[model samples]
Target: MRKRLSVSKWAITVLSILSLAFFFTLGPASKASATINYGEEVAATAETLIGSPYKYGGTSPRGFDASGLTQYVYKDAATNMKIPRTSAAQYKIGKAVKQNELKFGDLVFYATGAKGKVSFVAIYNGNGTFVGATSKGVKKVKMSDKYWKERYIGAKRVIK
Candidate 1:
C-alpha cells in the first residue's frame, strides 16, 4: 500500500509539471497582455519625470541625477524591483545586451573618464532617443549626441 501511494504521488507531480509547461507555452493572451502592460508602465513613469530638476545623488521628484533617474523610473515602472542607485553600480547588475538589441526601458550606459568608467544611464525609448537627467533637467536626448555617442558603453534589460 505504501508503494502504491508513492507512485500515485509521483504521477500527480508529473501531471502538475506538464500542465504548467503547457499553460506557459500556449497562453497567447496572457503573454500579450503582460507585454503591453510593461510597455505602458515604462512609458508612464518616464513621462512623469518630464520636468524634474537634475540633482546629483537625488532620487525623488524634487531632483535626480542620471543614476537616480534610472532608479526612480524603474522603481515606479518595474513593479518594485530594486536597481542600484548609481550608474556604475547599475552597470554591474543586469544582463549585458548589445547596442543594436536595445529595447524600450533598457539601461544604456556611458563612459565618463578616459579609463572607460561608467558615468551615466538613460532609458532607451526607441527611435534613436533616450530619456535622462542632465544639467538642464530631465529631457529626451538624441542617442547620437556627440558626448553620448562617444561614451556609449552598452545596454542592459532588467525588466525581463
Candidate 2:
C-alpha cells in the first residue's frame, strides 16, 4: 500500500511538470502566429497581381484601373475595412499620411492629370516603390521618377 501511494504521487508530479512546460513553451508562439499584419497582407496581395492588364474602370483579376486595383486589394485582403471605388473618394476615406511617414499598406495618391487633384492611387511598397495599374499594366514603379515625383499629391493611411 505504501509503495502504491508513492508511485501515484510521483506520477502526479511528473504530469504537472509536463503540463507547465507545455503551456510555457507554446503560449507566446501561439499568440505570435495569430497576429496578422494588415498592411503587409495588403501589400502582399497587391504584389500577386503584377502583370494583370489595366482597364479604364476594371476591378477584378481580369483587369484593373488605378483605383480599381486599390479597391479590390483592400476588399480581398482586409475584409474588415472597405474603401471607395475611385481615387478621389479613396483619398477622402483614410486619415491623411505625409509622404515621409508612409507605411507598407498606405495609399499614395498622384495627380497624373492636373496638379492638386487625386487622379491615381498606388499601394506603397516601402523603400521607394509603389504598385499600381498604369496605362501599360499593373506594375511597380519608382516613386522618385521625374514624372511621379513631380505629380505626387499626398498619401493616406487606410490600415491602422
Candidate 3:
C-alpha cells in the first residue's frame, strides 16, 4: 500500500511539473491595455452639467455645489468610483498630482476662503481648463485665471 501511494504521489508531481512547463512555454502574459479612458469619460459627464445652477449643497442635475458637481460627475460616469461630499474630505483621498502633470478628470482643489484650507474643488478639463460649480453656476475656467491661480491648493488623482 505504501508503494502504491508513492507511485501516485510521483505521478501527481510529474503532472504538476508538466503543467507548469506548458504554461511557461506560452511566455510572459501581456497586460491588456484599457480601451476606455475613464478620465475622458468623467470629463465628458461633467460637461453635460455645464449650464447647471449652483446650489450650495446640491448634488443633482437641478443644481450642484463645487464638491457636489465632482461627486455627481464621477457617479454619472459609471466608473463605480465614490468620492467624499465636501472638498476638504475629497482632498484627503487619492494620490497627489502636480499642477504641471495634471490630467483630465483629476480633481483640482482650492482654498477659496482661507489660507491652506480646501474649500472648493473642480474637475480638470485638460489643457489648463477646469469645470466646477461656482457662484455663477457650472462653467469651465482656465487654470491660468488670476482668481483660481491664487486660490489653488493642489490636485489629486481619483481615477486609476
Candidate 4:
C-alpha cells in the first residue's frame, strides 16, 4: 500500500508551484503592459503630425525634421524629460542599443545619402516598423526597407 503525503506537505508543494508560476507569468505580463502603453503613446504622437511637412531644422507644428519629430513625440508622451532636436544630437543622448533590442519609444537612426552624411531618426512602434514624419508626412515604414536596412546605424533607448 502507498502512503499519502501529509496535508502540510501537500499544501506547501502546491503553494510553491503556484508561486513559481505566478512569478514567471508576472514578468512577461508586466513587460507586455508597458509595451502596450508605449505603443499607444507612439501611435498618438505619430497621428498628431499626420500632415506636418518635413523641414530641416524645424522643431514644431510649424514643421519638423527627423530629430525634431523624435523630440516632439518624446516630449509630448514622456512629459518628464526633454530630448535633443537633431538626429546626430539625439543619437548621442540615449543609451545605445542594438537593432534587435529596440522597444517602443526607442529611437532608430539611419544614415541617408551615398556618403551616409544625412541622418534620419524614428520612433520604434514595437512592431516590425517605426513611425516618423518625413517629406511625405508621418507614416510607418519597414525597418527592413532596402534604403533603411542599408543605412541602419543602430538604436537607442531613451525612455529608460
lDDT of each: 0.82, 0.90, 0.92, 0.76
TM-score of 3: 0.78
Measured over all alpha carbons after superposition, the RMSD of each candidate to the real structure, in angstroms, is: 11.5, 4.9, 10.5, 9.6
Query: In model 3, where is the ten-residue run with the lowest total lDDT?
Result: 25-34
Q: Write the per-residue lDDT of candidate 3 for residues 28-137, one digit (tens) a residue.
A: 64345558899988998988889999999999989999999999999889586888899999999999999999989999999999898999999999999999999999
In model 3, which regions exceed 4 Å deviation?
1-34
User: Against the true structure, candidate 4 has what lDDT?
Assistant: 0.76
**lDDT tens string, model 4, 26-118?**
866556543336545765676667678877778787788778888887777744458876788888877998777777777888888545654
Q: Which residue pairs clash in candidate 4?
A: none
Name the best candidate (by lDDT).
3
Better of 2 and 4 by lDDT: 2
lDDT of 3 at 135: 90
- Deviation in Å, model 1, residue 42 alpha carbon: 1.9
Error of 4 at 49 (Å): 2.3
